[model samples]
Target: MSFFSRMPLFVLLIGVAGLAMLVPAAYAAATAWYEIARSFLFSSVLMLVLTALLGAATAGGRRPGPHGRSVLATMLGVLGVLPIALGLPLAMVLPDTGIFNAWWEMVSCLTTTGASLYAADMLAPPIHLWRALVGWLGGLFILVSAVAVLSPMKVGGFEILSSPYGRSERFRPLPESADPRNQPQFFLGLGADRTTPSARAMRVLRDVGPYYAGLTLALWVILLLAGDPGLVALCRALGTLSTSGISPVAGSVGVHSGVLGEVVVAFFMIFALTRRFWPGGGELRATETLRTDPELRLGLTVVVLVALVLFLRHFFTSFEQEIAASNVATGVLISLRNAAVAAWGGFFNALSFLTTTGWNSVDWQGARSWSGLESPGLLLAGLAIMGGGVATTAGGVKLLRVYALARQSERELERVVHPTSVSGGGRMARRLRSEGAYLAFIFFMLFALSIAVTVLLVSIRPIEFDTAVILSVSALTNTGPLAGTIHLTPSFESTAGFASNPWEGWSGLAALPKTVLAGAMIVGRLETLAILALVTPDFWRR
Candidate 1:
């Protein structure tokens, strides 16, 4: 343990990732997939040995405390460089796919993007298990970093709590290595002691890791009981908990567990909507506050609104079609039942995409069929952009930022109507309305800029404008499955194009495009501000 304390976070993460390979290796061995088993075993052993040597060499050095910038760099390394090592076994298993493809796949999984170059049926079950496992670990990594690293840095949604005017003496503007002045008050208020960031991370891991694993285990068991195969249950369970949307059978749409499984998954998806569902999440808030948390309320609102729009849109259209084909009374009853199903489908899909998990509801196709309308692909793209709560597995601009912007808009509108009126919702609300909203607005603009730049870089190839937009948003939002689901082109019959779809999936893309998307995934996971920090001269000089 002391030896490990001296090694950097990146080295430790690599060692853990290597140890994770053992799970797949053991499964492959049990299933008699000997060659695949051998690949994993060899990779695991190689990584562990290298990490051990590195740790020993660092044992005499000063312990690496979790400073904000160093943690950010470590995270970047985990998402970027760790994949090269993690993908070794993947490359060995899929020899035909080049090392770059394997690296891209691992990056997608490690970033919890859930994008895959290989189709659902292309990889062996063990390979899929490895992908899901990597994503699950990635989810844990982000959760820990959000609490320990970003909270102190005030870069993640915690920026909302920063001094509205400037850096309050209470909260420093910049984080420094081992600076006692830079403690994260928001998280520190949650029962965590004023300690180094690394200690806080370890404590968070100890508190949250078991529940995270247990939730995944519990979900996996329930899915199996719901009639899914073991492998499918395990993968979906990991995907759901991680918000990765990874699946052995493509996605939730392909699962055999049916509506029962979707319902169960939906219950667990609430975890992603707000961190309060987990330990250490209710920072500085009263017990009753969880019920009225802004993030939770905003997330639910988005899901319900999106669901209602789709339901109504499809219901009216389906009722008209049914009436033309049947008697009025019969059409009314049939449309009611169809509307119920469509509502459920819309609700489930809306929540899933809102969390940025990218899971398609099983009944989504039925809903589309009832309406005889093209899938509302753009609506999903929008939901993914809204994303889930701060410090959760889901990724996007985040719900808190959106909530802050909304609050600011309301305050602005009130001032417009009555130029001399005092606005109040308590100090927290006031902060959110003022500087929090200011920061949120800046982030929103930066996020949009990232999308435009990514789209521009992607379009340097032969991709169409709409296709480029979808792909860019998908990557930047860390919602990889979006690329395949959204089709901007409409057929002559007013349905999504099947015959002449312009966008090919990830595997069909050129090397340059894939590389650009991979970079976008890392940028999105790290968020823009931290990435900017990496390039700043002051960050290096410090």
Candidate 2:
């Protein structure tokens, strides 16, 4: 086996990620962005040195087993370790920025939160590349870990897959990795199952990685051909697949993309909200084909319905002024074109927000723009809370759980409305109606509680109630930029008579509040109940 293939998956990942940092360092050198290049070199060297030390320490001993310990260490290590190392260079270069701010920027990216402290134009080219690269990798890390780590454990959205009140799975420890002198390492799924976390995680990665990688590659080439700048295309491509929405340019795909490019991007963003779009993807037996996938169907329905509402709102609201400027025939033609553009904007933005990608459509205006009117901020926030597919990079309350909870609600109503009605589907379907729905609802309540607690904690620091609410939702939804900028609130003029943005609301705050939001970001990424469940004895006893 190759050296990389032989190493435990998490260790292999650290080594590979360290080596990957070298590419940007070389680019920075070629472009004369020497300071940021130095940062990359430092991070890379430190990462490799750490990896080497870990590897040598494990030699001629029972290798560290991929159990809960491996999973937690790797997850926390990635979140805690890389950012500090990466932040050092950033602090050295950005003289005004303290260590905390530098670390926040990276943590945001590494979480695929993509909420930038510094705007794209303000940063050196290499730094922009580094940010995009880190977000891109963060996105991939989420994807690989989702199918490998989260799904198998019945955590995240996969919690719906477990039968309510079901016993934990138990299995014999793998003999191949076992040693006579060392204790056996066992993997537990919800405290029931036993397997090697490393082997299973690596197997899922091997099975799913190439296909996902190729899809991102194809997207990159298509975007490049559609007229995006090279670096912008790279970020967009990676951002789209990962749904991190990191970009080299300001605005988003809609701002830079020509008509065709927007169309292309919209198509690919579908991959974020639905796993069935990927090869070797999820199979909810309820979805026998692409058309049957519940998440996709629900997402499309939402986009179209919301788009139609927004389209009519734009068209009807603008009717008098549009009719005044042109002859009746010319007015009709112009109105039709405007309506079409508005619908496109609505559909695209709704989908984008739903996936937590954080792109505002080209015509997503604070005030009426040439293309269309502003959408309701509330609408975007609602979609963001709805979230995307389970086991996909997109973050929110995943659509699958949402659907499960909804179906369960509908079934209860049916029971109340018609006592004689038979519950349809099958035995498992009926059980899902009762037990599955309860599990999903529990998650929903936990999500809401997290938001409430976050808002309460942050608002105590003098953040406005509205600002506090948005920050809480944004962080918990894994869509950090939602609070970074806003068009809602009537206008940019603050009550104090200063022109301010929503980012100012969060960004201008003291470090303690920002730190609170950061913790919320991690909570949203990890999911609330799953983390709590991980610690309870119930999770380990099985």
| Candidate-wise lDDT, in order | 0.81, 0.70
Worst 10 residues of 2 by lDDT: 491-500
Off by over 4 Å in 1: 65-67, 164-198, 281-288, 488-504, 531-542
- Candidate 1 residue 416 C-alpha distance from true site, Å: 1.7
Candidate 2 to truth, TM: 0.87
What range of 10 consecutive residues in model 1 has the weakest lDDT sum? 491-500
Q: After aligning candidate 1 to the native by TM-score, how far in Å is the CA of 12 from where it should be?
A: 0.7
Write candidate 1's Cα lDDT for 1-542 as tens digits.
44444567777787898899999999999999999999999999999999988878777877665445676677778889999999999888877776787898899999999877766665788998999999999999988877766665556666666543333323234455555766554323422234544566677788889999999999999999999999989999999999998988854544598899999999899999888877664432312567798888889988999999999999988888899999999999999999998999999999999998988888899999889999888999999999998889999999988988998999889999999999988777887888778878888988998999999997887777887788889988889888767764321221111221223356666777778999999989888857555533334442
Q: In model 2, what lDDT does residue 381 have?
A: 83
lDDT of 2 at 535: 44
lDDT score, candidate 1: 0.81
Which one is best on TM-score? 1
Every model: Cα RMSD to truth: 6.0, 6.3
